[model samples]
Target: MIYADKTDLIYSLASTRARIFLARPRRFGKSLLVSTLQSLFSDGLKYFSGLQIEKLWSDRQYDVVRLDFSGLKIFENLEQFERDFKSVLLEAFSPLGFNINKSRENIVFFDQFKSWLLTLPPDSLVLLIDECDTPLTSHLDDDEAFDVIRNHLVKFYTVLKSAERCLRFFFMTGITKFSNTSIFSALNNLTDISLDTKYSQLLGLTEQEISLHFEDYLASAEKVLRLDRNQLQNALRENYDGFCFDRKAQNHIYCPWSVLNFLNNPEEGFLNYWYASGGQPKVLLNYLKKHKLANPFAFDEPRQIRLSELTAAREYKDIGIEALLAQAGYLTIRSVCSNGYAELGYPNKEVELSRAQLYTEELLRGKNLDPMGVPMLSELIETGSLEEIVARFNAGINLIDYQTFPITTEAASRACIQLFLMGAALMPEVEKHTVLGRSDLEVRAGKRHWVFEFKYAAKTKDAAQLLEAGREQMRSRRYGVGPGAGELHRAVLVFCGETRRFERWLEIEDAAD
Candidate 1:
C-alpha cells in the first residue's frame, strides 16, 4: 500500500526554513510526494502511522498553502501564460473566500497570497508550489514574455526567502531546472536537494517496489505475454532501470506511469512514457539543429554547473548537459560538489535507453522510424560481429539523410561508412571519442578493444571494389595506439555501396584466423 517516501518529504520540508527549489522530470511522482507532505502537515498522522515522519515529530496541524499548479495547462502565448498563471493563485486561495480579480497579475497575486499566509499564526505558513517550472518551460522560446513571467516568479519567491520569520516552510517542485535570467536568480537562498541521497527514492518506482506493490499486474503481464518472471523483469529492466538518484542504491527506479503502461499494454513495450509527460522536446531539438553539438555522449555524475550562468536568461545554449538530463529525468545527481567540476551521467540502464531514444529522436528531427533497428544493432554489438554490424548500418542508411551536400558516389559511400562508424561510437564504449590510426573509431568495452572502419561506394563505379579498398585502408591503419595494445579483442571493417553493405569482422578467436 503506502510506500515509505514520506520520510524524505517530511525531512526536506522540516529541514528547510527558507525557500526550497526541487526539480524533477514529469511522472516522477512529484505531486504525490507534495500531497503526502500536505497530509502530514495537515496533522493526518493516521494516514501515515509507520512512516519516518511519525518518528520525527508529534502530530501538529499547520495552516498550509498548497498551490498545485500541475493541472493548469493554459500555456501558449504570453498573455495566456500570464493570465492563467495569475488565475491559479485565485483558484488555490479561493477557498479562503479571497475575491481576487483578473487585474491582479502573478506577482501581485503571489504577494497577496504570501500576505494571507503571514496572517496565519506564527509557524503556520507552509507554502508548497508544485510544477513551478512549467510556466517557464512553456515559454522557453518567447524571450520577451518569459522575462516578465520570470520576474514575477523571482519577486514572488524572493519574498519567502527574504521573510524567514513570516514563512514556515517553502517547497517547490517542477520538471527541468530553468536556468538563466530565471526565477532561481531571485530565490538564491533556495536549496536544491535534487541529488541528496536521503531523498533519492523520493520520486519514481524501484523494481522491488513495483514487484512488491504490483505483483498482480506482473502476474497478469506474464500470463498475457507468455513470459516467465525473469524474462519480464529483464524486459522491464531494459526499458526502465537506468535512472538512479543514489549511485550506491542501484535500484533507484522508473516512472510509475511507464510501468503502468507496460502492465496495461504488455505487447507494445515501453511506449514513450518519457515523451508523454508534457512532450516538449522542441527546445532541446531546436538547439541541436541550430548548432550541431555532436558530443560523443556524456555519462557521469555530480555534473558541475556555475550557478550564475545557469540562471542567466541569454545563455540557453550554455545550459549544463547534466542539468538537462536531470530535468528531463535521464540523470540524477549521484553526488554534490561544493567546489570543483560536477560529474554527471545516466543513473542506470533504463535512463540510458530513454536518453538514447530522446537524443536519437531529436537528431533525426522528428522522424519516428521503427526502432527495430535498435534491437538489431544491439544484437550485432552483442555478437561483436563486424559483418552483421555493417549490414545493420546499411539497413539504416536510408533512414539517415546522406545528401547534406552533393558529392560523387565514391565520396558519398565513404561518408556513409564513416557516418555509420560515428553512429556506432554512440554505443557504450571507453575512450569513446578516439579515432584509431586516423581511420576507424577505436572504442574499448571492458577488456575488449574494438577498431571500426567504414567505407562506401560512388555512383557509376563498382561498389564491391570500393569496399575492398576500404578494408585495405583499415588494415594499413594498424590501430591499437592506446593502453590496451596487445590486449585488442576485435577489428571490424564495414563496407557499403548501392547493392548493400558487407562487414569483415575478425576477433582474436585464434592465432591463425
Candidate 2:
C-alpha cells in the first residue's frame, strides 16, 4: 500500500516561492512525489480523484519539463561525463519537441534551453529535475570528475535563476544537499524545504496515512500473525517506523519502502528491505573509513546543528557525522531540544540491524575470522552457553591485529561482541548506566539476562584480579537486579598479553532454576 497522500503539498507548492528544492533519502518517494507534481501541473486531476489533493487542487495545465538524471552511469573521466551528460539532457528534452543544436558543454545547453524557454508563453512552464545530485554522488571518489559535474550542474542551474520570468514553477529533488558554493551557488532563489515542518510528511507515510491506506493489510496481518490489531500496528511501528523529519511534529513517519515490502510479505518477518536494496552509500563508507569512526552502531544523543550546517558542503571535514547520516536517512531526528538541536538516531530496527551488519563486516575485514562466526556468537547466547560465547570471542580477538592508539584490540573486541549480538536482534545495550555505575554490555536472550563487564590486564597474573574486579563492579552496581532479570548471568571478561578469559561468579536463579 502506498501510504503517502501529499495533496496538501500542492497548496504549499502554489503559495510558496516558485523555486523549490527538496532533499530526501532515496526510495523515500522523491521520484513519486515528482510524478505527482507532473500530473498535477499537467491538469491530470483525474489521476488524483478522491484523494485529498483533488478537492484542494486547481485545474490548470502548464508546459512541464520533467528531467530525471538517475541511472546515468558515471564515466571514467570528465570528458566522457560531459559527453554523457549532454546526451542525457538532449534525450530528456527531445520528447518536449525541442530541436536544439548538439552541444557537449553544459553552459551551451543551458543557453539553448533558455532560448527555447523564451519561445514559450511567459509563466507557463514548469521545470522538475529529479535525482539532481546523482552526477556528483556517482563520481564522489574522483575529485576531477566530481568537480566537473558540480560545475556543470551549477552552470545549468544558473539558467533557472536567469530565466525566472519565463517559469511558473521549478522543483528539484535530490538525496544530498550540496553547499551553496557548489551546484546551488547561482540558484540562490531556490528555497530548501527538506526540513520544513509543513512538508515533513510530504514524502513518507505518516501513522494515520498507514492506518488509512493499509487498514485491510493490518487486519489480515493481525489474523495471520495471531496478534491483535494494536499489537500488529505496534510491531510494524517498531520495525519500520520512527522516522521523524520535524522534531516538533508529534507524528513519526514510516519508511514507505520498508512498510510496503513488509505488507507484501508479512509472513517473511521484518527484513531490511530498503537497506538491502541500496545498502550503504559508497561515499559514506569512504568517509567513515577515512575518519576512522570507531562506533557506527549508535547515535542516541541529539546533535546540535544550524540549518546552514545541514546544507554545508561535504568538503568540510569538520562537518559532524551525525549531520551526514541524518541527511542520508540512516539517522533521523528523535526529538527536538529547546536549544534548537535535533536529537538523531536510527529510524527503526531495519536501519539498526542493517547498519550493524555493515559495521561488523568493516570491523572484521582481513581478520581471517569465519563470516559465519558472528552469527555463532548469537547462537551461543541464545543457547545460554557462556563457555562457547567466551571461546568464540577469544578466538575472534586473537585473529585481530592490535594497534596501540585509537581503536585498540580491546575496544575492537568489545565492539565486535556488541555488534554480533545486535546483528542477531538480541537487543544488546552497551554502556548501560545504573545508580551504581555503567555496565559494559547488557543483553537478553529469552528469559536469561546477561551482563558483561570488560577489563584489561597488562600481565597474565593480573587477569584473575581484573576479572574479579569486573565481577565485583557488576555486583556492586546491581546490573542484573531489574524486573524480569530472570536467571541473571554475570560475567567478567579479561584481556591480557594476547590472551582472553571469561569468569562468571553470580547467577540469580529463575523460578525454574
Candidate 3:
C-alpha cells in the first residue's frame, strides 16, 4: 500500500546546507527518509515519479554512499565493533568501485575515502548514514564499551567534516542525540533539524496525510468495526497519533510504523504495534530505574522545557526525566508557550498504556505479586467493591520487599496506584481538584468513580485519626462532581510503619445529596 508522501522533505533538503543530522524515536521513519534521500540523489525523478518531489526536484545525480550501522551484528567487544565498522564501510564503498582495505583503521579508511572523492566528479558525493547511534546506544549499559564505540564513531564522522568540500549533500539519522562532545563534536557544521518546525512533518504521517492515504482503509475499518468515519478516525488518533516534534507544528504526527501496521491488519483491532516491535531501550529503562520516578507514564500536568534545553544533551543527573522521556518518544510536546517552552505529555493511549504496563511490572518485580493483578484491581473497582480494592492494595503492599516498603511520601503511593490502574486501561487522575479541594487519587472504570485518600502516620495509634482526617477532607472537598460522576466509592487508607490498611469505606449514591 502507498504510504504518506514525504517528498516535500526532499525540496527542503535541497534548499538547505549539505550536512544535516536528524534524531527521532525508533520506528518513526528515519531509515525510510534516508533511503528516500539516497534514491533522490541517485535515481533522480524516476524513483519519485508521481510524488510531490518529482515536480519540485531538479534533475541531478550524485554518487551516493549509504551506510546502515543497524545491519551490523551485535559486537562482543570494542575490537569486534571496530572490525565490523571498517567492514561495513568497505561494503558501502565497494559497490561504487572504491576498494577500502579491510585491514585499515577507520581513520585511515576515511582518509582514503576522502582522497578518492577528489578523483570523482566534483560535488558528486552524497553521504547518507542511517542508525548512526546503533553502536553507541547498544553499549550504554557498559560505560567503558560505550566510550569506545563513541570514540570509533567520532573518528568515522570526522571524515564527513574534512571531506565536506567534496560532498554535494550529507544526512545522518538516529533515534537519540548523543551529546555533541560525545560523538559529533568534529562535525560542528552539521545542522540539527530534528526540532525544526519546517521539517517536523518530514518523517511522520500527519492527520491530513493519514486521511488522504488511508481513506480506503479507514472506510474498511469503519465498516468492519461498525463505527462511523469520524469515530474510526478518532479511534485511530487516540491509539496511534499525537506525536509532535516541533513546538510550532500544529499537525499531530502519527507514528508511521504504527499507522502502516494497523492498515496491514485492520481486522486485528487496535494494538501496541510500535511498542511491541522492540524492547524498551536499556538506556531509558536504566534512567527510569536510577531516578526511581514514581509517575513514569503521566505527569500530573504537561511539563515545560525551553527550546534550547530540549535537545541540549546533558549528563543523566542534569537531564530532567520529562526531557529524557520526551526525547525517548514515550512523551511528546503537548503545547508550546510564548516564552519558548514546550509542555510535554504522553503522545497517545498506546504509549500511556504500554508504559503503564512496563512501569507496573518493574514496581511489582521481586515483590512476588502478580504484575498482571492490575486487571483484577480494575475488575474490583468496576464491581464497586471498595473493600476488596482496599484489601488487594493492602495485600500488595504487604508483599513488597520489606526494605522497599514504608514509602516516604503520599505522592509516591498515589503514583503507584495511578500506574496500576492505568496498566489495566482504567483512567486515573492524581491530585484531581474539585470545587473544594484536590483528591489524592481518582480512578474511573466506566461510569464509576473511585476516590481514594491516603493517610500516613508514624504510629499505628495515629492511623485511625489520620484516616478519619482523610475521609473528612474528601467529604469537605466534594470530590465526586465531575464528568461521569456516579456512585462515589470513597476509601481512607492509612499507613503506619510496615503496615497499611483501610480505616474507613463510604459509598455515597449519586441520587443522594
Candidate 4:
C-alpha cells in the first residue's frame, strides 16, 4: 500500500492536545491513524524513518498501551462482560512485561494498570483507543444491558482519566460520539476534533494526497479506461470525493477506503466502493429504514442543520435524522453560513446512486410492488423504445400507495421518478447542481446522458403546451453545462393533477442555440 504523509498533522494534533477524540464513518482509516501513532510513540524516531513527522517530532519514546474496544463483546451479565474484556487486556499488557491478573474483574485490571503507570515518571505513557463506542451500539434495544455496558465502559475510561498525569498522549476514535451526559462525562478535558477544520482531512484522503501519492495508479487506470488524465481525475472525483467536515466547507476529501480500492484496481473503473463495502453501522441503517419516509428528499436536496447539532454527540435515538445521516457519511457539509448553519447532502455520484437504489428497494418492500419491475426498467433504458420507457415510469409512479403516502409537492413527485429511474440503472441525480442552474434530474444510460426538467400542471394545458414550457426552462437556463456535459439530450416529463400520472413525456431534438 502506498502511504501518504500525514505525520505533519499528527505532529500538530499530538503535540497540542493530550486527549483527543476523532469521529468518522467506518473504514475511513481511524484504526490506521491510531496504528501510525502507536508506532511513532512506542518506537519513536526510527519507526517514522523517512516520513515527514520524523524531523518534527521530538526524540522521545513512551510505554504505549493500545486498546481496540471493537473486540469486546457485550454479554448478558456483568460477570460475562468483565470476563470478555479480560482477554483483550492480558494480550495488550504482555508486551509491557506484566501478566495482568485475569481473575480480577474488568475495572480492577484497569485500576491495577493505572497503578502500574504511576511507577513511571509523570506523563510517560501513551494511550490509543480505537472504536471506543462499538460496545454500546448493539444494546440499543436493551436499555438495562446498554446501561450496564455503558457504566462498565465509563469505569474503564475513568481509569484513564485518573491516570491522566501519567499519559503523554491519548487518542481515541469511533463512528458514533457519546455526549457529556453519558460515557463522555467520565473523562474530562477530552477534546473532540470530529468537526475541527484543521483535522477534517486528518482521516480522509485529501485531493493533494491523491494526486501526489497515487499518480502511477491513476496513469494505469487512464490507459485502461481510454480516458485522458483530466477525464480520469474527473471520474474519480465523481465517484469517490467531495466529503467536507469543517464549518467552512473548505477541504473536500476522497474516502480513504474507496480511494485505496480504486488505486489497487483502477482498471475496474469506478464503483460504489464505500457504500458497497457493507460496513454501515447496522443500528443507524435500522433507524433510517424506519424513518425514511419522514422526508423523502432528505438526501436529494441540501439539508440544513445547526452547527451545534454536529459538534455535540447525542445518543442515537435523540440525534435528528439529518445529523445522524451526516455523521453516518450518507451526507456531508455542502456549505456553511455565518450564523452557524451547515447545508448537507450526498457527497458524490456514487453515494447518491447507491442511496437511490437502496431507497427504491425499501419502497418496493413497503408497497409490495414487484421487484422485477426494477430490472425491467434497466433493460428498457438500454434497448427499448421511448414509449416503453414512458410506460415503465408510469407504472413505477403508480406503485406508490397514494392513499398512504400522499404526494402534494413537486419534490415528492420528482423523488418518486428519480427512485424508479435509479432502479433502472439510469443513475438519476435529482436537482443536479451546475453553473447555469439545477437540472431537475440528470441521468445516464449506456453512454447516453440526459438533462430532465419536470413540470406540474394543476390546470388546463395540453401535452404539447406543458412540454414546451419544460423545454424553455432547460434552454433559457442551460441547465446542463458543466463537467461530463459532452453531447446531452434535453428531456421533459409532466404530471397532470387530473390524470395523476405522467401526462406527457418526450425527449426534445434540439442541438444548437
What is the lDDT for 86 in model 1? 65
Models 1 onward score TM values of: 0.67, 0.86, 0.86, 0.85
Q: What lDDT score belongs to each candidate, Candidate 1 first?
A: 0.57, 0.70, 0.73, 0.75
The window of 10 residues in a row where model 1 has the poorest summed lDDT is 293-302
* Model 3, span 1-513: residue lDDT tens: 585677787778964547888888888888888888888888888777788877898757878899998865387767887888878887887787777656775547667876666676657788888987777666556678777777777777776676677778889887677673355578877788878888888888888988887788888887788889888888889989999888584756988888888877888878788778852665577666566664443444567778777677666445777777777788888888888888888888888877777776666764533345354776788884766776777666665554553455566566656776776667677787777788888777766777787776766677768776776776667776655677567766776654554344444443233
Output the number of the lDDT-best candidate: 4
RMSD of each: 8.0, 3.7, 3.6, 4.0
TM-score of 4: 0.85
Query: How big is the positional error of residue 491 in model 1, measured in Å on the Cα after superposition?
Result: 14
Worst 10 residues of 3 by lDDT: 504-513
lDDT of 1 by residue, 50-88 (tens): 667666666467767799765544556667766776677
Cα lDDT over the full model 1: 0.57
Arranged by TM-score with the best first, the candidates are 2, 3, 4, 1
